[model samples]
Target chain A: MSLAAFLTPESHSTCRPVGASVLGQRLESPADIADITRRVWQDSMNVLQAPHIYSGVEMALWDLLGKRYEEPVYRLLGYDKAFAKQPYVVVPFAAVPEQTFERMRHIRQAGYRAVKTGWSGFGHGNIASDLSQLAAAREGLGADARLFIDAARIWGCDVVAAKRYCPLFDQFSIEWVEEPFDPTALNAYADFAAHHGRMRLAAGENIHSIQQAQQLLNIAGIGVIQIDCGRVGGIGAAKEIAQYADLRCARYINHTYTSHLALSASLQAYAGLERQDLCEYPMDPTSLSWSICREHLLVGGDGEVTIPNAPGLGITISLDDLQRYVVDLEIRIGRTTLYRTPSIR
Target chain B: MSLAAFLTPESHSTCRPVGASVLGQRLESPADIADITRRVWQDSMNVLQAPHIYSGVEMALWDLLGKRYEEPVYRLLGYDKAFAKQPYVVVPFAAVPEQTFERMRHIRQAGYRAVKTGWSGFGHGNIASDLSQLAAAREGLGADARLFIDAARIWGCDVVAAKRYCPLFDQFSIEWVEEPFDPTALNAYADFAAHHGRMRLAAGENIHSIQQAQQLLNIAGIGVIQIDCGRVGGIGAAKEIAQYADLRCARYINHTYTSHLALSASLQAYAGLERQDLCEYPMDPTSLSWSICREHLLVGGDGEVTIPNAPGLGITISLDDLQRYVVDLEIRIGRTTLYRTPSIR
Candidate 1:
């Protein structure tokens, strides 16, 4: 679902928030957005899993609001200035230990001081394989660099299974272990956090509401709250969580894996928080993700990136790329066309 | 989304669980259900809000499983026998106090011992109107009958607003005040539960997962835990919560306002718990809802309802009604057809 919120066509300040999931209901006009969002909130039993449609619509609304006010989204969100963040190169674990080492080495060579390797059978394999991968990642990053391991919820609720890798994580000096258990497995998270040595639990990328994030911080004992703006009901919700995390004395970070547009939206939430400096940057994005924005927030000499100072989300959406990648779609109920993809002007 | 799960077409035990929300993705075969459910869990930030699709799918799977085993769903769920539940007539508040009185009187005359009036501007109006309605309902039902007030979440975290009617609730001997605040407003629920009078807090119909139901029982201080199997990831999740509620000594009830098919599915969760007897029976269902099931679970002279002893959900789906109501739906991407409404044979 690609939503462009605008006051008028002549204003020419269209805001696009591309939602990956399709909405269950049809929106006749912009007036329906709030009502639909409220219905979604009231009807959905789990706000965290059902907030994608509302999230995208909310992001677009914020973008439009920013453009109307002629200020950056961060400024509109009450931040006087956007803070610079240390960009961590995010990649998946390679097929083998040597490949994982090479990937980490390449990231280090590319001036990224922090790197995260996740998914791709990381925790699913044998203990020896995991140890080799961890050893390779640490050796390749060369000691001083920050290394984050994302287990991607491989262990579910099994504390014993997750604890097996804790010694290896401690040996590798991992900054944090991300999503070792399911998000709703509060007991498991708390238990794991209590037993783990040195490494802190980091999660909340899947959080859609403020309450879930607070639960993770308060009950799950996570040291880091990673929020994705596009997934967490847009910037407003993410900002709320960031503020809550600050109140609870926890680190807040943005989780971005898609376009630079998403990256900017994610950053605007906690862009003013200088202390929570790390930002997850997609180092090897798919072509579709890369095509969404014309200009990217590139890493600088200091190995840090800042959100654009210009108005709205401060990134221009590439119409040409969107058109090239656009799939012509239509949804028909009986004889009536409920939805048809609008032509890119 | 209507799903029919079966091991084989020749088995003649097609189980249908009609989902209120459309699925975001297309399922190629039965094998995709588990994978899609997992994706929905992982990708959705709010599982409670996003589990509708999975819930319906899950119900269908359980129905099929029960049919294969030649036993009632409750028995398959590990219950030795299904217990009879006290049926309560569920209706919206009338337009005026007199109408409310008449409605309650009518329900009483029809032999229902318990009645619940909710929504339709119940708590939205001034305190005087609420009191008048409450008085009228109580007087019409007489002194012996149980009265449940469904606030329909009109207060929205306003403890003061909800508290204004507490004295009236106690005076009328109201059994429970349902959803006085927003489902996610844990603080408000806890606050209101702490200060409220005789009427206990009842909630959990909006719960989509076991964790959420448990949270309400353990943290929110709700005495009555209502589970809608059609919404809370099907019978499995509802049964889990019922057991959890039993362990915590919370009153477990079904929140059904749809077809008899849904009512049966809802009943199956807590059908084994004899002590938790109240079952919500839709007294004012829409025509479409009424037409969905061939056989209805009518309240007996004993003022109680029981699940069918037959295999599966027991109630036969009205194919004629489904065909009559089925809207022709088609989704197309480019030249390829992703989905079209399956013909009801």
Candidate 2:
């Protein structure tokens, strides 16, 4: 279980953040570098021993290891390169209608089989208007593509949101509706599930810990349990919960914690995991989506990513890349000027 | 229910994060930030209907407000600050033997009623030496003063840990031993707890979500339940579990996510709570232990902090103070050179 053996044989390499010119520190030891990643992951947001608490690092270290490992991240996670395509989503929150459609078209062309969209707000003025948008969005996705509408629990259109949403779920043939109304709304969601049990609900990554996962599972028995590994702190706990999901007949989906390494580690946790569907490959357009980790995650022609073949994680760090773009870690901007401290050392 | 009315008419300073510092953009309505806070608090975390995922930020805001409001956060739920003095422990870690004792004397000088120490390792040359250290540390603490000892539960010390550590607890007048092992080792911790129930069994904040809390509560009630507001993702969920503890006749303590504002907020919640003892206040020297919401949490002369008396937590964020320290929201620190990103603009 020690990632040591797998990590032992790697030449050090540097990590470059996307759009940045300078190199980050070149990692010397994969295991030691991995420890740094783990600590950072633990310190942010979620601080509980909840369902899971995971830590990961190695943008600089992972890069060196990737080259030494001679394979990508997916292959390391036990994913076969043949099925190297990844399941993904397109968040159309701030996009115009045409832009969203265009984005979806590009994603489709780029080999993604499914796309999720329409999450900013349900601004239909009424439930009917919201429903119409869903109908149209589904039509745009067409029969060949899978479409997910992220309403973010805007199901408060009174009777429409509560009673009518599920039927609409069936109408649009939605893959699964997420956080239709937050955790408290589980009973309402359950009510929907009880009646149109076929309308499949997807949620849980928003949950910060395992105990919450257990409560959510007990309360709703969700169709697709989307687990956010980072929010819980790390991959180990997610592994346990994913196993529980497999045993319980519910599908587990990796909840995104905003980085490819976080996403990749979760993909590994899902290895041999039953009832698991997709590990959200957050391919946002921001340089952030590209530079946040040590390596750029890719999907193969088969619509899945081959898990990293190297030990620990076959992450490739590019210090030069990250330094090229980063000016500070904690930045503050006022209307007149931005206050930033460069890494003087 | 709202916090605005509690503030003096002249109180209107707002602390804006430098990156988003256009002050008036949010002050459109009559000074009613608490109105929004209340709504977000109510709708998102608190009263979030069961089976919902709780986020920590929402609760932290509430905790911050409670301090600002000069009222026990729990007082909002209609409970009073029950204790006359806020009894808490200063964590002692990362210190050599002599230095740790020297620091303990200073903690005593600061008027703290109790102190807790972290675990180093347990065994020596493998086993015997480590246990000897534990005994020496316990003896040292007792030699200087009567205080509580928190076993750092570094794991793998067999039943000897249980037997040796269990009796040492009584030798030091240690009220309750913390985690001491993995979460699943409920039996092991319980075994130790059973060995000393009259002293009061303490645990939780590590137990994520309500489901795990339920498991802990079921495994024979511990005297004190420490819940971490950050880990649980907000005050609403923390309260739900705290209230559940009230229902079950167990005491609850806040797990430390100790920002000055958060501490005040916890005091407020404790005011509203029925069953709960002191919060795990981190006395270690970190900026986090003091202030973060652009406010200072002043402890009352009585030792117990008087919960905020103003609307929300009565915290007035100082934009100037925030600007002084925050460089970037996220920085990538590698083993060698840490990257600095430009200030958020």
Candidate 3:
């Protein structure tokens, strides 16, 4: 077989390229990927005991497997059907409620299908002010648009408080209330679900793996199982969770308030899922998603973006862009450091 | 209202004596109990931000309410009918398999009707080793006895691992498999349940409050919702969870690997439910349950204990035994320290 190439710019040149030769095994199938990844994980655990350290390696393996199969990673993972992604833009909280309302309008005008706002001012302070902001956002986005409220885990609403306050958002036509309480408080989540049966409760962005996703979705009344590929291990794990969510009849919303790389990865995974109805597209103006990649994977006028078809993540990394934004850089070969930028003094 | 009495010996005198006067209210009804507990909980959260700190106070409130009503706390909690207690004794993991076998025999001979063992010898070991111990216990206890396996969250088996290992226990007539993975691994638990469709999965003892229990019970495939009153806030919270579990058609098994006081407390909560089928009675010889209370809440030959009918928590507090067993004591009066034991010389 011809050499499978991956470019590494001068800054991160020491990082090893992944291929059959580098892995010391022929990357012929998913079984081979599993065998190598498991061994790599075992090796890491025996030495460093850091399971998270292997995620990047595992994701890269999936990319290579995609290239090897001459297909998108989703299709390689057996998702043959096409998915039309209807993206939702998150309207991050502004100190001024009116400014937040304006941003919600901008999000709708950006051709986004849906919008999400936060609960910064909801649980405490002037709840009426928060309610008004939600109402304004709903009004700005128009009646046909979907609106979601993300408490972002800062809203310290207990089940009782959540029950008392969540329904107040219903008048604005809130699609779902996300993370109204401590995520660990699953029962509290259930109570909120029970009390606000009319409104949907969504979670799982902070959830760590496919297994945790399974548990969260198994929660009888949970309506949405939010998936962020970066937080939930990697694309491999996300696909597994998305499949499980489909089986449970829960909505799979790719949580994409992450970097361009992660959002692209999530898009690839979402492309193959049957329930790819809506996804998070960090459409917030201040987000770094647009600037990080050489080529923009922009959300079009209809609120959808084409899944990248290029081999291995389908986006070119701009070395200048990485250097401009990165706080520090280091390159290592085994235990020896090949290079590292000097600390900014 | 007249002053109510409580006996707090010198050793545990640091523990507050609960009364209507101390609570600064007439503890005349369950409504009053609720009012006080909520206030106490709010005050603690405001000052200390630790909700767990108020559980003892909340439990004491239940005791006060029970005393005022001249009934068991369960009856005060709205369980109006008779319930016959059927108990299961937990046979915690023994060092040796044969020793475990002997302990199981002892448990049956001790008049317990059902038995529970641990996962130390199961999951990873040759399946037969765990199976033999279970079979030996089953044979000793007779075919009619119910057997359970408590992994105690040590098995570390994922849903895949659980699916592979759980079915092997079916021949031994295992009642349920308890927490084969980290309790936080809810997805793993769900997956295990999904795979082992024939076997029942039980959990919730480590759960801290009624909300969590409700969440765990709300999880699909969990057949048994185990409640340890001490861990689950108080008898008040346990009653709430038991009620929810009942509605979900899940079995309510009181978890009692605790002191006699907590065991008695759990029994009170257990005795009120229509599903008062099995409560855990730690039958290990080394357990303090055998000698803590002045009068033993003895298990009959048929493996049951009558609910303590005395006012409050029905069992007599053995002062001498408490003093002997207690490692240290402290008492506080509002912000002032009333007493604290001297450090060991």
* Fnat of candidate 2: 0.15
How good is the docking of model 3, by CAPRI class? incorrect
All candidates: DockQ: 0.41, 0.16, 0.04
Q: After superposition, how far is residue A31 of candidate 2 from its true place, in Å?
A: 5.5
| Candidate 3 off by > 4 Å | A1-177, A180-345, B1-28, B32-56, B154-160, B163-168, B181-200, B209-219, B247-249, B284-292, B325-345
Per residue, candidate 1 scores C-alpha lDDT tens digits across B1-345 of 112111101111111212322245454433444555555455442322345656766777767767877788888777899888889888667889999899889989989889888677777757788788888888889999989988877787789989888888889998889999877677688889889831299988776667778778766778888888877777778888998888878899888877888888899888888888789988644567778788888877777897899888888888998788897877676887756888997
Residue A25, model 3: Cα distance from true site in angstroms: 31
Total clashing pairs for each candidate:
13, 116, 3
- Each candidate's chain B TM-score? 0.86, 0.67, 0.80
Number of the predicted model whose DockQ against the real structure is largest: 1
Writing each residue's lDDT as its tens digit, candidate 3 over A144-165 gives 9988888755444456666656
Which candidate has the top score in TM-score? Answer: 1
Interface RMSD of 3: 24.2
Per-model TM-score on C-alpha atoms: 0.87, 0.58, 0.55
Per-residue accuracy of model 3 over B1-345 as CA lDDT, tens digit each = 000011121212112223221346766777776676544332222111122334455567777667766787767766664365777776665766677767777777766768787755556656667666666677777777888887756545455656656656677777788877655565566677777652378887656556557556555357788876754557777877787777767788787765666766776775766655677765444645556666556676555666677676766666665556554433333344333444433
| Candidate 2 lDDT score at position A149 | 60
